[model samples]
Target: MKTYFRLLSFARPIGRYAIPYVIYTLLAVLFGALNLALLAPLLTTLFGQHENAAAIAKPEHFYDVFKMLNYYSMKINAEHGLFRTLQFVCLTIVVSVLIGNIFRYLSERTMENLRIHTLLNLREAVFNNVMDLHLGYFNEERKGNIIAKIAADVQVVQYTVTGTLQVIFKEPLTLLTYLVMLFIISYKLTLASMVIIPIAGFIISRIVSRLKEQAAAAHTSYGTMISYLEEALGGIKIIKAFNATPYIKKRFHEENLHYSGIMRSMTRRQHMASPVSETLGIVMVSGIVLYGGSLVLSNNGSLNAAAFIAYIALFSQIMRPAKAISTSFSNIHSGLAAGERVLALIDQQSQIKDAPDAKPVHQFREAIRFEQVGFAYNERMVLNHVSLTIPKGKSIALVGPSGAGKSTLMDLIPRFIEPQSGAILIDGQNIGSVTTDSLRALMGIVNQESILFNDTIFNNIAFGKPGATMEEVEAAARIANAHDFILATEQGYQTNIGDKGVKLSGGQRQRICIARAVLNNPPIMLLDEATSALDTESEKMVQDALNNLMKNRTSLVIAHRLSTIQNADHIIVLDNGNIVEQGTHVQLLEQDGLYRKLIEMQTFSAN
Candidate 1:
């Protein structure tokens, strides 16, 4: 019940649709009952067949539908000819049906609008929460599961609100309206026949007993299947290279089969509820014919041939609402299970939220200082008491072997990952005390793998600065050595770059990334092996662009090749999560330490 209500809250201003829906549904039910009740008048009055016609007195209360109908119907028949009375009753029944159908259409339309509004709010909420989560969260959780919750589970949850409406208000009220009319015609028969209702409910509940559990399992399995799909798409190159096509296909097929089996089981159970209820309703109707027909034939009871016939019609329709309610229970279980997954995503809190009193930083004046900073990943230490200073307008290089924590150290400067101990300060102000947006605004980053959107070159270059003109973009492109290659393309700067810049070569892609960073024009730059992935010819071109980009900016670069950082102001050599040496290229060579050994190894590898 709690989960059901929480999902409904997404349909905010629910009264906008609720009040009108209730009114329309009420009118539909009222007129629909009249449509059936008029059968009694047609049988009794028009045919001139009631034995006690003389005893028919005017009903005192206006609410006495059956008595009023009988009184007026007989009055019309006597004053007017038989054909005229038939016209009056038939017209009344026709009008009742038309009005009833109109109101039903209106009620259904209102509910559809409510479903769309709820879906809008729920999808937006899930996406907004997802975008606000910290980077580490994406690393720890599967992307497919997140995508499924945002896209698929949210879809399932919206229908839960509709199901809830049917269970609580729409179907129940309709059922009540039918029952009230049945009791009015013959209360004794109505009272005696209520025994079959609870029995049908108990039997239907047993069939859908496991739907909620299975639905939860199905959602999990779906997420897993989606995860497998993502992995297959992302690693297609590796799969083909190793000839693992058969293995991958077999693995995916097994999960697909499992998910399909679960859905089939759920469908079988969900579908059984309606038939079971309908069959029980027919059984109840058979019993009513035996019991109530005896009362009409005896002629001593209130149940007449006309009224007994009307009673049976009303009783048959009462099962419709009952059947709808049972079907909704099945839907509600599936929805609530999906609702739990979507709500869990919305409930996720980002660990890297700003402090309440965090200040906004605008510019960098002095150096970025790391004072005894330490960090670890899952109990494995990556950086230990690391202290470094990158002064304003100087390029400092960090060179190390694999798993030496250089990238992790660079990530700490931007607060991408916080240090376990100690503080990093920019111009004497603690970075942790500043807003993440303002802090990140002062720096530009470039990774080894070029990250470009599948958009035109002009749009990609001007991504962050939305209002940039062509002149400004051309200037940035010129600085990164990409302006000539861009203009040489068929569409020039307007050329569409395929996914992740696949349309361009490695060097061309790297130049585009550099151009993007240059357009932002931050004073602090972090380059993570920016030119290491390029060939000799491409590397030289990118190296020159890097030289131009770092002319006066304070730069912290992770140098994969020792030759690239030989000209750096200060080079920090690290091994085993600790800085072993710090000096210029010549001074480092004089030390005969880990720095000298690395230079020799790189030189040997190059030869």
Candidate 2:
């Protein structure tokens, strides 16, 4: 219930929609009931007339619609005759139906707008929160499942929640209005009908009792199937290379079947509620007939022939709203289940957040210092009491074997993942004390993989600076050696680079990534094996671009090929999260320590 209400909060200022909807609905219900209530007078006018009929006695209270209708019928018959009275009653029924339908149309329009409004707010909130979540959350959770929650689950919640709310108000009012008229005609019959109604409701509830559980299972199955589809698309090349198409096809098919089965079960249970409630309602109507007929046949004064006939007609209309309420219960259960999943995502708190007193830092004046910084994952230390300093406006390189914590150490600079212990500072100020956005603003990063979006070359280059003009983008592209190829494309810089820059060569994509980082023009550059993935010819061009970009900037490079970093002012060798050595390139070669061995190993591999 709490989760349901929390989801409802997305439709804030609901009174704006609710107030107008209520007015329209109430008016519609009023006119609709009047249409059925007029049935009594119509029957009385058609049958009650005779050759020497006297005037019908008017009820004491004017609110007694049936008696008053008869009195008016007889009065009209004496003056205007039976033909005129029949025409009058039929015309009243037509006008009542027309006005009722108009209000019904207006009410439906208002409800649709409310549903759309609720969906817009909910989808926006979930997506914004998902974007703000910590990077590790994505690592621990599946992308497909998150997409499902934000997209599919949110859609379900919007319609069902609002629809059930509509039923809660509109259906019950309709039922009550019918009941009031039923008792006015014959209280004995109305009381008997009310007794049988609860039994119908009970039966419908039991039939749909398991629908919520099935609905929850259906949502989970669908999410898992979506995840499988995403994985297959992402790794299509690998699957093709390994000749695993059949295996992948079979795997996805199994999940699809499971999801389909759950949906089929849910549909059966949901559809069953309508028929069961309707069937029970029909049974009650049958009983009403036997009893009400006796009252009329017994010449009972409580119900005249006209009143009894109108009473049964109004009673039959009662089944419509009653069936609607039962069906809405099934939908509400499904909606609540979907609501729980969506709320769980909204409730998630990011693992990283700015401190209450955190201040924003603007410049990188001195150096980034790691004072015995330590980090661990799953009880295994990835960075162990590591201490180092990257001084301002100088090139520093980290060279090591795989799993030596080179990338992890570089990630710490941007606070992508915080150290489990110890502190990192910039110009003697603790980085944690600074706002995350401002702290990251001092540095530009280019990763080992060329991460380019599916966009135009110009937009991709200017991504770091949204407002960057053509001249600035061209200059940045020149620095990264991307300007030449960009112009060589069919549209020059306007050429669209398909998904992940697949439209361009490996070298072109990497250069564009460099161009993006250069456009940012931060004081510090964190290059994580930027040239590692390129061939020798492409590597040299990218290396030259990297050299141009790093000019007069503090650079922390994770060198994949040791020969590339011979001129670096400082070379730090790491082994198992420990800094084994640090010095000038020549100084390290002279020491003949781990650095010299790495240089020798790379030299050997190059041959």
Candidate 3:
């Protein structure tokens, strides 16, 4: 119930729709009930039971609704002819139906608006919260599952939660209105009919008792299927290249079959409720006929033949709403299942957030200091007692084999991942005491994988700087040596790059990435193997561009190819999560340690 109501809050100002809908629905139910209740008098009038004109008595008060309707009807027949009375009754029935349908239509329109509004708010909330989560959270969770929660699960919640609102409010009132009319006609028959309802409700409840459990399982199955589909699409090239298409297809097809089987089971149970409720209603109606008919035949009976027929008619229609309510219960189980998943996402607290007294960092002047920093992932340590200083306007290059924590060390400067032990200071201020956005604003990064969106080259280059002019973008491009190749494309700077700039060569993509970094014009640059994946010719061009980008900036380069960083002001060689050597490239080589050994290995591999 807590999760259900939390989902409902997204339908805020619910009163706007609720109040008007109540008014419309109430009027609709009243007129519709009156339509069925008037059947007795219509029959009495047509049968000519009160043949004499003077025998008809007028109703004393309007509070007795049925008596008033019956008296007025008889009075009209007394004054006017039989044909005129029939016309009056027929016209009243037509007007009642017309008014009832109009109110019902208005109520439906209001509910539809509520549905759309709830969907918009719920989906937006899910997506915004996802975007706010820390970078590490995405690593631990499936991308496709997140997509399912935001898109498919939110849609399910919208229909189920809001649809249940209509069932909760309108259906019960309708059922009550019918019961009142039935009681007014014959209290005994109405009481007998009441016994069957609780029995029907119990049966329906038992049938749907396991529905919530099944619904939860179905949600999981569907999410898994979505994950498989996303994986297959994202790695389609790898699958085809390695001739694993058959294996991938078989895996996805298995998940699809499992999802379909669960859905089939859930729908089977859901559809069974309606028929069961209807059958019970019919059995109760037959019992009512046997009991009520005996009363009419006996001398002490209060019901006339005409009122008895109308009572049965109203009683039969009672099951319509009852059946609708029962079916909604089954559907609500599915909705609440989905609601739990969505609310769980909304309720998840992000692990990374700024301190209450955190301040903004407007400038970076001196150096980035790491003091006895250590980090681990679940007790597997990555960086241990690692300390380094990057002074102002100087280039520092880190050379190491894989798992040496070079990239992890650079990530700490911007607080991408905080150290479990020790502290990092930016310009003498602990970065933890600064706002993440303001701290990140001081640096630019380019990774081995060039991250470019499928958009125009100008837009991709000027991504973080909104409202950047073409002149600024071109200047950055020229600095990265990307201007000439960009101009050679079909649309020049305006040409749309395919996903991750697939339309361009590897060197061109790296240059565009470098251009994007240069456009930021930050004081500090973190280059992580920017040219490691390119050919020999591409590497030379990219390395030259990198030199231009790092000029006069405080730069930290993680060098995969040793030749690129031979001229760096300082070099730090790391192995096994510890810094083994630190000096200028020439100074480290002269020491004849691990740095010189690595250079020999690479030199031999190249030859």
RMSD of each: 2.5, 2.5, 2.6
lDDT of 1 by residue, 1-607 (tens): 8988888888889999999999998898899999998998888764556344456778898877988888877777777756776788899999999999999999889989989999999999999999988888999999988888888898888777565774678788988988889889988888878988888889999999999999999999999888889889979999999999999999999999999999999999999998888889889999899989989888895788888988998998988888888988888888999999999999999877788999999999999999999988899988899888889999999887788889889998888888889899999998999999999989888899899999999999898789999999999899999999999998999999998898999999999888888898999989999988889999988988999899889999888776568789999887767888898989989989877887778721110
What's model 3's TM-score?
A: 0.94
lDDT of 3 at 525: 94
Q: Estimated TM-score per prediction?
A: 0.95, 0.95, 0.94
Query: What is model 1's C-alpha RMSD?
Result: 2.5
lDDT of each: 0.88, 0.87, 0.87
Rate residue 271 of model 1 by lDDT: 95
Question: Candidate 2 at 209: error in angstroms?
Answer: 1.9
Question: What would you estimate as the lDDT of candidate 1?
Answer: 0.88
lDDT of 1 at 295: 93
lDDT of 3 by residue, 1-607 (tens): 8878888999998998889999999999999998887787788788847655557566676655666777777878878977788888888989999999999999999999999999999999988888878778888988888888888889999889899999899999999999888888888998887887788888889888888888888888788878888898878899999999999889878888888888888888888898898889889999999999998888474887888898889998888899889999999999999889988888777777899999999988999998999988787788889999999999999887778888888877878788899999998999999999999888889999889999999999999897999999999999999999999999999999998898999999999999999997999999988988899999998998999999989999988787678989999888777899999978998999988988888631110
What's the number of clashes in each of the models?
A: 0, 0, 0
Q: In angstroms, how far off is 565's CA in candidate 2?
A: 2.5
Instruction: Point out where model 3 deviates above 4 Å.
Output: 48-54, 60-63, 297-301, 603-607
